[model samples]
Target: MSEAEAVIRNQSGYINHTAKKDYGPLEFTGRIAGGLRLDLRRRLPLYASDWTDAFKAENFQKSLSSILYLFIAALAPAITFGSRFLDGTNGQFGVLEMIMSTAVSGVIFSTFAGQPLSILGATGPFLAYTLVVYDMAVGADVEFMPFYFWVCMWCSLFTILVAVFDLCALMKHVTMFSEDIFAGLISLIFIIDGVRPIIENFSENKMSLTSAMFEALLFMYTFGLATYLSHFRRTPWLLRPIRNLMANFAVTISLVTASALAAIYSSDTNLRMLSVDADFSPNLVLSDGSKRPWVVNPMGIERSFPAWAIAYAILPAIGFAVLGYLDQNLTSVIVNRFVRGALTLPVCAVLGLPLSVASTVPSITHVISLTTYEVKQLPEGERKVPSKVVEQRATNFLIHVLIGCALFLAPALKFLPRAVLQGVFFYMGIASLTGNNLFDRLFLWLIWDPAKYPQYHYIQKLPIRRVHLYTLVQVVCLGILYGLKAIKETSVVFPFFMASLAIIRKAMRFLFTQEELELLDSLPAEEEDGKGLSPEQPDLVNLEKSKENDEGEPAKATMGV
Candidate 1:
């Protein structure tokens, strides 16, 4: 086969040779059967065997970086969602519960999940739904715990049924267009959330205007410093290792430096520290100064399960199941496009589960924080691209375990400045947005000169109008989801909105040519091949091309098959 044909075949197998294969109607039984059979064959073996082949002595630095990145990353959501739960319910679900759930879920997921890299934690949508359920129970004059127990039990069953039947396979229809928009929106939310506190404090009349202004300025300084350090790679005076260290630990260092500065500068001013309330005890308790057991049976004979609730609960349970399945699988797809794993729904049922939230932020930040060094060429030419010393999964696993252990230290972590975490979130948001293809294309449109535009494959092959249309669709979807999330009542249906985006993507084939759609949806050939290869097995052809480019040689054209 010729080179171009080989590239196409290597990237997508037989898909390009035929008319694009249409996924017919969703087959419920077939999917279930497939999942069951696959489970029987692989689940036991995988569970029994060692999954930690990814961890090695060589990956120590990468693992350490991951632990540090996740510790800070988990802290934001833990505080945000934990506080939300506490405020909404007057401290019914305490900070300890939130931290405990996060730590426990992380440990369980990292150990058992097929994809260990995907981080799991308390999510805004799940927390919103919980509050809604709590309010509904209160309005109905029902005991909140019993009512919650029934819903969770039903939701767990539904989640298991979905997983056992392999309904997640349907997610194959979700293309990069949908994934990018969802991820981008999340990133934007992080940035907005970070800035919101400063804005709110600035407007408050309680604090003096000068103090408020100083707080806002402090945030800007922190954000600016973090962004600068994270992106600072071009300084020649700094040693290579030192430069890499700064970039890799930029967020952690910036947070510390900024916090110290704020503490000293705002010693007299009333600057806010992260509001975390924990007694550092293992016991679970109710808001009414009542003792609650750590392990209460949800379906106990003592508590009556209302007949009406059984009927009412099924719908919400299914909704939760859909939400869990979609969020988990979507996160897995985004983290490592190659490895898709099934979640244990039964476990989620027993322990109030945490959904994977803001996974890209931590994963990307972990990668960015690692020190990389460029290898010099033999003689006097351009240096090779900087390379990471280790992979990130082992670090991901360890971080979760550490966070679980760190729950006891919650009292100390409360002193960590909220503004510093906000600055980290701000950095995370910008990083995520910048990395998306849709954002890259949008940026290309802003450039006044076409000659200055980068040679992206889509730009060269697809009509510019079509490209813009595709981007417009993503932006519109992002706006809808973001709007839904901002409104409390609608946010629970965020997963449905995400599913709708996938459906919209499937419909796009009618509007655009198959080849163009394929290009938009599928991974590039180099990336596709690289996914299956070890780091030592470099793409020799690409390497050769890079060398030729460095030596200023004209590229040769490949013959068509």
Candidate 2:
């Protein structure tokens, strides 16, 4: 046989068994989606015959898992933060509202739209800004949350526009380094934001930063121990359906147990117990002209500007436009990376003015958080991304449809607790960090004596002495930011400025020695294989995949088969 047919025949054999057990192989129906149907369909296989049904199933599973993931990523931090908000403001949402809200925006964004697996919901910056705004708006006669909801609706509309236009390709210029910096920016926010309250409450709440951190650490250990015991006992084994989605149920179990203990011990020892609710009564946001239960009509007064503020608005608008563009497209590009569904920058842009209004959280700031998912489940015989990536399109569509249904039912969701969701947020924050490559890279640079942790050597080209200099710069800068963030107003400025420093540093790269430039260039040249995990590294460690075989982008996209 010729080379082409040999490859095709092998791929065909591969797809038949993998895509679905009952399915024989991929065959085109001779009809396309654009209302073109031909009876004598050739049943021509995919461009790559190695596609399989089992692989498709795996992708579907990953998409489904995202629903649970989004629910958790959002609520875990939210529950804790919400409790703190109530402690600060004295309101309650019960467990239901807190949990539902976490899933609400995520469900609407993921389900109604193409980016089902994108995993949207509350972000730290948005929450920070919201609390500040909500507090400020309370003093004014005008509504607060109605404006927030209006902003979300606007952003959602913009997202729809992006999906229609298919402008996601504009994201090609965003690099891995840029993405990492943005993610670091978010994580830095988490640590600092999380720290501020802990420090302040240290005296009034009778807590210390070290003690709270220790309590958080203890909570981690408790969950770890519980997980180990659960696995060790093997009682949950009979629960197979839930077992496949163990992480989903894990937050519920851990937080409940932790809260039980906190409640019991809280009164005696002054352990901070989480608040149970997040008050969502339509306050100033909807009080005026409160006609429909949840709708508002803004009297079309020309959106005004103060004489002093009017001049400043345009420059900030330009700045907002730049940051908004960077944030949304960067997020869209990353979303498209893991998710099979198409993501468009225009979607973010369409949502742009709304995001600026509702919550001007930068899009690129998303990469700061991360999650790891299996891209494809390789068959026993076949290898590479050819397996799951084959039936990617159909599976993605199905998953989004399912998530949409869930979102439509989101308001009725019952039984989840606020603390549990907070635990989920805590878990997601920790889980997303799993995708970060920096911690180990830095550890290697600082502590590892070069002889060990060779992977660090590959990632950062500087020598041991130079590694110390790099570590010193990072530590000192991060320490200063951590300290200054306590002042509240100063926090946002530091991160934006810190990120700006990177631009300056990149420009300064030109001043380096030719040899230093060569060394700097050597980093990240080793590309990841399109495959999910490398076989060489057993425990989710990524390896350099052969460059030739990198999947160009989403297997299913505007490019078409």
Candidate 3:
């Protein structure tokens, strides 16, 4: 058994993760052009097929369900981030801009991009950048919008150059190590934001204990019920069709049920409701406190504002571009399993919308909602492996269309309680962490008994100590990113800090062997039937048989089989 274990540990590197392509370096224009040509060559063939596959009869139900799931998933963040923008930009941008940006960018990306599954919305880093830029404008005593306009123009220009130069190919250096850390940061942010309300409510002592507890209960109900229903497909209680329906519309069902209860008991509960603008209009407040027009006038500025400031805008734009490119491409790589195109940042600037970058948690949620899985009986129990993804544009198109339609539904949305939405945020944060490998490794720290370990591919291939070390490194990096986020002055360089994760991951090569790094840092590989079961199953079976022999009875055990 010991010999077998050693062999498995030494030889099982590639089993757990997908192989990353080494793009080397694009040292010259020739290489850049070639990369771009290759990208176009691969993508152009799929364009027509992408559209045709979107509207199939069988796709409608799944797409419809995804629309509902993604709408709330996307909306909570849009509104949350929009509120932050309002405070940070002093009402120059708010929920209206976020909604419009998400609605417009989402529709366009779904219809035109090579990959439609990756959702684009306002992100925390971009919000941080906006806040920092606003502070800079204030310090200069200049008009905010005009300075913002030049920054956007320059940022957009840089983003275009990135795409044109095929710079996204550099994402090859970003292994699962950095990806998981980045993902964990985003997930933690969602969780923190969700929990913030409860902290504030209790800390302020504004509400009675009963009312506070009642509000907290509503929050828990939305999160708890939604989470439970999402996993209903795995339960044995219901028929397959019913379980599927419940699972697909889990979030929607939970939100509606919770919101209804909150509304009915609103007078008794006195819970805070979603605050929305009275009308669907521009959120940008002018110098005299009047709302600006829908379009941001690029030329509007203080008389003393210098033309030199326009060129100076490139300094900040560099950071925004790097952040935008990384945000857009990293999520794109994860969603598509290959890098896809992104040029929406420029449009965001033109429209005075929040820079629409790929939102990690929401994008992950969208992909998971559309994915199909198959349950196979293993030695221990039934396990679901991804079978196919419903990669259609119709779902995305309709999702944003609903968001656009939501603009006019302000009256209807007003009654929805903040607690319910925060519950969704909590659920999203928790859900996003579910399949993450970093979380998987960190979970091992609590297992004191080595025998209790699940036979995950990584566990079977590497020492527990080494796995913990890798996880610790990731945690340290995440802490740094979080720290950068916490400090306002440092937040302007937030994207640059995020980009540094790739460098941090590269430094891991000195501490671990090449094979060990593969198991620890690579993306999970797909399970195929003829590929002789996953690396964990055979070991699980052998362990079960060994236990049976040792005890002279049937082994009642399955360890992540």
Candidate 4:
């Protein structure tokens, strides 16, 4: 086969299955039924087996490690978003609500989702929409909770409708062009979010020099050391098993070590600490000036919502429903495959909690935590990539179970420094970029010499200009998304802006030739050869199917294909 043809044939991850399906001639209702069937079409047969594998005795050890890593991975954001909810909604929702939403929604997803490897949590856009709803309630002189409840209720209904209609089958239109830009934006959010707080401490000049410096040091220590240990397996310093163990537990080790480091400066008042409620009581105060109950009465909120408001709620609901659809499905596709999010909507809405969507960092981190990497010495350097992922639900199920348990441990969790968590944020953002194709290409600009470029398929097979053009297009789209997400007034349209990326990607055909696009966009040949966990086999892991050497090392990694 021609090199370009091979590239095209090897390419995967587009929603081709849905796009190509011949759901025989059907009327509207029939199509809707077919669409719903299509949602579970691929996963249904595998459902029973998925559950069996989840509880295998051998999976427990790995699940335990993953549980610890993901617990921290999931916790930081719950606290962060909870704080945002409290401030944005005037104590209508806070840490308690956020935790409950995550813990509850996560348990449901882990127990029933086709791909439980993906994690769900509140996202920034979700937070922005909640804030907008709060503003509407305030302007209308209505109770925020009732309006919020109705909005969430309508959102849940819309989300279910989208799922029922199988609207996500349209994902066939999305491509790496859009997915990478979205991934890049999410990654930058993590990196920037991590660095922003430390920089603010210095810029705002809020604390004593010693305290600020200590905070900065703590952040660096966590990020730098964790990064070093995560790659420990790549080095020749220890026994193979020992290095692997360290690499697997890198995040857990980093958090523990950082927490210990922060404890040394517990007396330093300027160092920010994680804030959680001493109890699990609702933060919102009712009209009677009493703490609201956990269960929000849809019809009996503090202020009696007008009947028109019930219908009016659909306006905001449309935005959130679309956002949830995109975030949940797209991130699912990014991690591995599509999974139904229709179930999470109503549950979160009724609880008056921030609705959870697929969290990019944590979901990807969950995959990485379960992945076993094989390191090989190459002429260039040591190439490390995923060989297999211990796909199971037990870890996710137990992780959130522990998160729910955190309600009782709030007093202890409060001791963790905010800077330490931010350090993890920085580490996660930086680590996630390791396998990003866009990130790799962006770094290519630094190499002026052609001979120095790594022997990546695209770099070797495609024209350098073609590769650069593809990367540039993604960069432009990322800039637009960043703008949309950064401005409050524009943020509500953020989901639509994300939708625009698919259109932008489609428009790229006019810019690059079909052959060039394939080489630039396709997953590597090994990935399509059935030796990876994610069908799309996204660049989230620097995966390459290495061939066997004379020593008879296995020709393929155990990808559980």
Candidate 5:
């Protein structure tokens, strides 16, 4: 059994706790996405204790193995945000440039203190930030293009210093109090991003919830079939080859295939066609030589960033630096909840710059989102690794290099229906919620004596309705962002509202809670011998009384526990 699996066996109180959660109509979505199996116990290990076996000496190998996943994860943010930065008019090279940049960053991270399964790439948070920055670039008199890159360059430099300085250790200081707030913030991001689009589309596009539901269902079914097939090893028949070929290109390839096949059948509600938005116009094909398309100003735009004047943006650079570190550390801690092993930020630093560039590109994010959604939703035991560092790094660094090579060679790439990319973003939203259940679980534990969380009991500290309500609201938010392209329409309002709402709600909870908090107080010290017998091992709880200490021990729960 893997280390993570052992923990599950040891910690039944936690899993049994959440088992009764009513999955609702969208229940299958969670199972299909591996949601039911997501180990909530991972949250506990974020602290220092559940780690008797943890020793961070040889995780480099796992980090290397993690490269493949990281490569894909990075792809999501890269493509999603990168496309925006690429030329708005007749631009094609943005995709290629973004791919290169992401690959470069992957190489860097693969080289240093990498974690194998944590899967770093351009994330939704970073992508969100990019949108805000890009908006600043638009219509600004300042040469924002260079300003942007200049800021990135400094952020990169700062990240490298931070990594080298081992600032990742600061994550250890992140208190459970703060962690709950932080995780709640991230969870809100996922939810709100998904919802707003669905709500707005109800009126704007006149897309009935039924139509939206169908689209969602199709997306899920197609993705489910792809994932199922990818995992298939039963018969090496046509299913294996076809599944492998299709999944390799991901949803992008699948959508295109469905489109062509649909055209042939002329089916109702066309399932596939070159899935493009009404605003997007296709230009040169992959075969056609394309010019380098960059989002920039030609009329003397180089003065600001090129000159020493770029240094003035140092404070802004500091802000981005903090954001990147916070995101990275939080993600790593979440990963470590289940995945043991030491990871350093130095490698991340080596990779962050290139990653930003790739994120600046468009296709990479599409790839990352689709892939990460699938991988992250897998069960705990299925995802667990050892508690060693160098071993993880060595393995993942090599894998990154391999995935990077596949990325560089465009011909070997293009395969899937790009629609899966959005699915990936959806999956991530789910992950953000379940990834850190520590606070809720901890609160529940405090409420319960030695049994389990409230999901297993009749009544909970907080209303089950509240948890479900928030989750549903988040789904609505996610629908809005992904479906309506809220980044262009209502991105800021949605995310801000989600985050702000959480703050307000949490504050209210703090003020209104009537339940008294429990503190772990110690039992009084009993006198031993005249000289003090140094509390001689307090006779084993379940063991029969010792010959010398002629008394049966107390029950296990009331004893040491």
Candidate 6:
């Protein structure tokens, strides 16, 4: 048996205790139905304990650092992307609405959410769906805001129903294959969107080709440098803490550096800057002084609500809820390393979805939503040690609420160069893609040295051809989703496309073995083991084996047969 299996077989008692003490009813193998019985009395202690542990004196610095990192990573990109759905002429929701909704959602979710560490924000699929809705409303000659309001209401209600009824429990069948494909698609969107503008502008102005190329180069350089610096831990002269700090703040550093370079070299060029207005208002009013209410009332529209329209609205609402639930939970799985949990809520992209549905009340004690795109093993004397950083979800999200207050600072927002934000998005996209195991395995064979290639559990256990076949399936799914997104009319169905992935996952079980599927879906052994031990504990099995060898005894069973 593999070391992991052996550990599981031998550690049942420990697992039981850990499950009871540290895991929630819906987390791991605990009963999903039992989560519904959870109340404030049981949940409050977990929150309070986590809050207290998160705010301890020694952890204060890390919490503050997380606030800075998450703000830059989440907020600026949010404003940039969210602005795409705004149509001032048609009175659609604008950046301010996006910010307000996200902030309110963050605060509300942080308070009552299940997975405290899952960061909720505007996503590309949702943004695309919203844009589609705007087009549909305009095409039908209906007021966009009113139509959107009703759609959002329906979507939110659907999400709540899904959460209440525990429909997300069905998501267990979705393997990493589907999750990775979804995440990869979103990452590619960010990268393409970031690069597309520069390419388009270059094509439009022949005379400015030189300047545009220079601008593009500058953006690329800035993005590359920041990415490099973020993971640059090899500076022997620098202290470990300083290296960690640099890695932590890499995205922000890249954005500032790129912006400064653009300002110095390409200020006169057609490169765009963030267009936040100097005069700001939290109240709902378009730039043209059209009154837009903060709360959307479906009945307030000029046109009568037809039954067909209501029926049509329900499909998209279900689609949106499914998309939101998938995006939020998939991100949580990637971040928290929990595979078998159900999301208990609906998500509205325009309003910004809450994090995950799985109440992480039990696991919140270790860390909040702070997650990295990469997990690197750093050398610590004789063994490599995994880094553990707390996400400080409550504190960081509260900081996001504070950053939302900056929406009124039009001048400051405008000063944030659009290229810099693009660079940030590009960095995020590249980081996400590179971090994905599927992405890695897809190109694994291209490596010149097989010995140097990563030996993940899937690669070790599954035949090479099977690995390639799995990747091909994911690519085809990605292409279909991308194709759907390419057409404006079909873009609104993007959420439904995501929902289809679950169905696709179920069908794939017929093609692959249960053992292969389990390996593909399972969390990494290191992550699984790390969860059960305190940071200070050594790897006892490895230590014992080493001692046995040193004493010249017959080697005990090891991982390899």
lDDT of each structure? 0.56, 0.36, 0.66, 0.67, 0.37, 0.54
> In angstroms, how far off is 130's CA in candidate 3?
4.0
Question: Which regions of candidate 2 fall more than 4 Å away from where they truly are?
Answer: 1-104, 111-116, 129-174, 195-202, 205-249, 263-293, 296-324, 333-386, 390-437, 445-448, 457-462, 466-486, 489-502, 511-527, 530-561
> Model 5, clash count?
73
Top candidate on lDDT is: 4
- On TM-score, the leading prediction is 4
Q: Write the per-residue lDDT of candidate 3 for residues 400-474, one digit (tens) a residue.
A: 888887778666766777777778767766766765778877888899998999777778878888988989988
Q: For residues 227-284, what per-residue lDDT tens digits would candidate 2 score against the true structure? A: 4432321244535334423422454456656656554544444344443312333211
RMSD list, candidates in order? 9.1, 11.7, 9.9, 7.4, 17.4, 9.4
Better of 4 and 5 by lDDT: 4
TM-scores, one per candidate: 0.73, 0.55, 0.77, 0.78, 0.48, 0.74
Q: Model 5 TM-score?
A: 0.48
Pick out the ten consecutive residues of candidate 1 with the lowest summed lDDT.
552-561
Model 6: how far residue 317 lies from native, Å:
1.2
Task: For candidate 2, give the lDDT.
Answer: 0.36
Q: Model 6 scores what on Cα lDDT?
A: 0.54
Error of 3 at 361 (Å): 5.5
Q: Against the correct fold, how does model 2 do in TM-score?
A: 0.55
Tens-digit lDDT track for model 5 on 28-141?
Answer: 322322222332233333323222212333323223323444444345444433343342312322344444455545454433222332333454555555555445445344
Candidate 6 C-alpha lDDT tens digits along 1-561: 124333543454333434445433234324343334332223333555545645777667656655555555555555656444443223255556556555655555555554455444566666666667667766766655556655666766765555444555556766677777777777777788767766775778743776677667766876787667755443554775566456545665666677677778665676666555455543245557665444444544345655456556666667666776676554343212121122222223333222223211112312322321122233432322234445334574565577577567656555555556666667656655644666777788587676776777777777777877877888888988988887877877877878788788878889898787777766566547544332222222211111112222211111100
